[model samples]
Target: MDSSSSVKIVSKHFVKPKTIAEESKQPYYLSPWDYAMLSVHYIQKGILFHKPIHYSIDAFLEKLRESLAITLVHFYPLAGRLSTIKTEIPKSFSVFVDCNNSPGARFIYATSDLCVEDIVNPTHVPLIVHSFFDHHRAVNHDGHTMSLLSVQVTELVDGIFIGVSMNHALGDGTSFWNFFNSFSVIFQAQEINKNDDLCLKNPPVLKRYIPEGYGPLFSLPYSHPDEFIRSYESPILKERIFSFSSETIRNLKAKVNQVCGTTSISSFQSLTAVIWRCITRARRLPLEQETSCRLAADNRLRMHPPLHRDYFGNCISALRTAAKAGELLENDIGFAAMKLHQVIAEQTSEKVSQMIDQWLKSPFIYHIDRLFEPMSVMMGSSPRFNKYGCEFGMGKAVTLRSGYAHKFDGKVSAYPGREGGGSIDMEVCLVPEFMDALESDEEFMSLVSF
Candidate 1:
């Protein structure tokens, strides 16, 4: 059977919130941090689970559909659509969420002929995985007409894939996982006592975190969203998963600390350094060329007053560190690790506040094409997220996967290993030539378990 055509959609519909109060249907303003992500693509991520035994597929889908409605009640902004307000006097535009005009979140039910092994056992993730997510190649600004949140449940012969495509402007990775976790909690609770009222353990703090001098709405620099939108066709890229066990990660960290004579290097930093170095070597760029690594850091705790962890919007800052290709390649892993550690340490409350204040004065939107500069690597999604704990009464997830949106030559996403511990799984994307070079680099593959 053709893998691309294997996934067949059984039904598709919209799931509205169980209940929405009239007063709660007011506009939800976008934070400055959210405005900065206006042009980025939607975030597409999902989990692969072993098919549950003893439950009919019909019954399972019904429960999932019901719980989704209940979950939307708490995460109401997701059900809402983006609104572009224009002012004639100023000839400017601003965007906000119109809660009153919600058309509900998109829900899809699909069936695939593939099995668990078809997804988990491949060195390169199969192309069929891209079919699991909706809103393919759609940017976050498309939320003005598209659903801000889309959920797809694709059933395999021996597994299930629950894919979610969320608007990047609405939240960051922290917010994305929070919604997934909350949905699982409500789903599992229904299995226990269907009659009981479900409540989120960490209910989302929906208040927008605007700076002291900033108002709820900020005007876009452009007159229309089209002027700010960028179009780019992605090149053919290969994606592979590299697994690092707890022991391997420890050894990497210990090696970095031993060389640097400091214990400040974290496992994440150590791992990212190795990838940056290896990819640089694989690319075979000129010594004089400059390379950079950009990582997204959560800002909820870095705010002046420290916003709640449950804050339901974009609260993140990109930490970028650069080096000449020659310098990066000549240095040991310790050198690269320390560079990342230093940048991470610099994101203090004052620094975060300054970043917010500066952005308010001159707001800039991130274009998709500009995200992938040459010789650059972008690290997204942290291993700290509880990817495996999203249990819907059907055991833990076997692994995680991402969709086609926001993918570039050097995009890397980190996930906690399925076996737990400090292990990590990096979903790496690169050109075919670069991937071949990376797979053959023994020094780098020596640390990878798979």
Candidate 2:
């Protein structure tokens, strides 16, 4: 069967919170960090699970919808819509969440004839996977009219895929997973006791974090979203997951430390170093051309009066480390690893605050053209997130996959392996030519487990 054509939408609707008081309907201001992500696309990710033995699609949908409504009560901003306000004093516009007249979160139920293997066994991830997510290609700023959060449950022949697309302005990976974890917990709890009142172990802190003396609302530099937001079509790309066993990671870490004469190098840094080196070689860029790697650093713990772990918003900044192509390729893996380590180590609390303060002063929005520079690689997501731990009574997720949003050549996402114990699954996206060369590069594939 044609997988794309076989997939059909069963139902689609907005899922509102179970209970929200009128007094609590105040506007939730977007912070500088949140505003930085206004032009970026939604954070699209999905979890694939084996079909439960006694699974009934109808029953599962009912339970999922019910649990989501309860989850929305705590993550109320997600159920709200984005609103733009004009101020005459400075003649600027500010964006905030309108909690009073929320249209609720979008929920979709779909069905497909494909099986689990059709998704996982491919050498290159099929484009059909992108179909699983709603609000395809919509940027975060589109939340003004579109739903801020969308959930699509696609029932496969022998599996289930739960696709979640959250506006990047709403939260980061940490916040997104926190909401997913909470939703799963409530879903599982209801299975055991439907009448009991469920509670989140670590409920989200809704208050926006702003530096002292800064306005809670930051004015947009542009007069209209159209000034920054634009349609972007990436070059044809091939995505593949490169699995690194725990032992292989350990070896890489040891090699980097031994060569650099420093024991502080982490596994993630070491692994990313190898990826940088190999991809540079594959692209075969001019020796003098500059290349950089962008790492998404979480600022939750790096803040002055550190925000709560459950802070429900974007608290991430991209730390870029650049080197010439010749320098990166000619040096040992330890050199690249050390470069990453130093950049990450330098993001102290003061540094994070300074980054935010500078952004507030400039108020620049990220455009698609500015995001993907030449010879640049961006590493997003993290192996440390509890990707495999989100269980909604159908057992843990078999694997996690990302949708087409924010995908560009050299975009890499890291996830913990299904078997767990320190292993990592790197979901790598590169142009067709680069992907072909990287797959054949023995030096890089030597450590990758098939």
Lowest summed lDDT across 10 adjacent residues in model 1 is found at 1-10
Q: What is the TM-score of each candidate against the true structure?
A: 0.97, 0.97
List clash counts for every candidate, in order.
0, 0
Please, what are the lDDT tens digits per residue for candidate 2 over residues 5-75?
Answer: 56689999899988984634788888888888888889999899999997788898999999999998888
After superposition, candidate 1 runs with Cα above 4 Å error: 1-4
Let me know the TM-score candidate 2 reaches against the reference structure.
Answer: 0.97
The TM-score obtained by model 1 is 0.97
Model 1 has an lDDT value of 0.88
Clashing pairs in 1: none
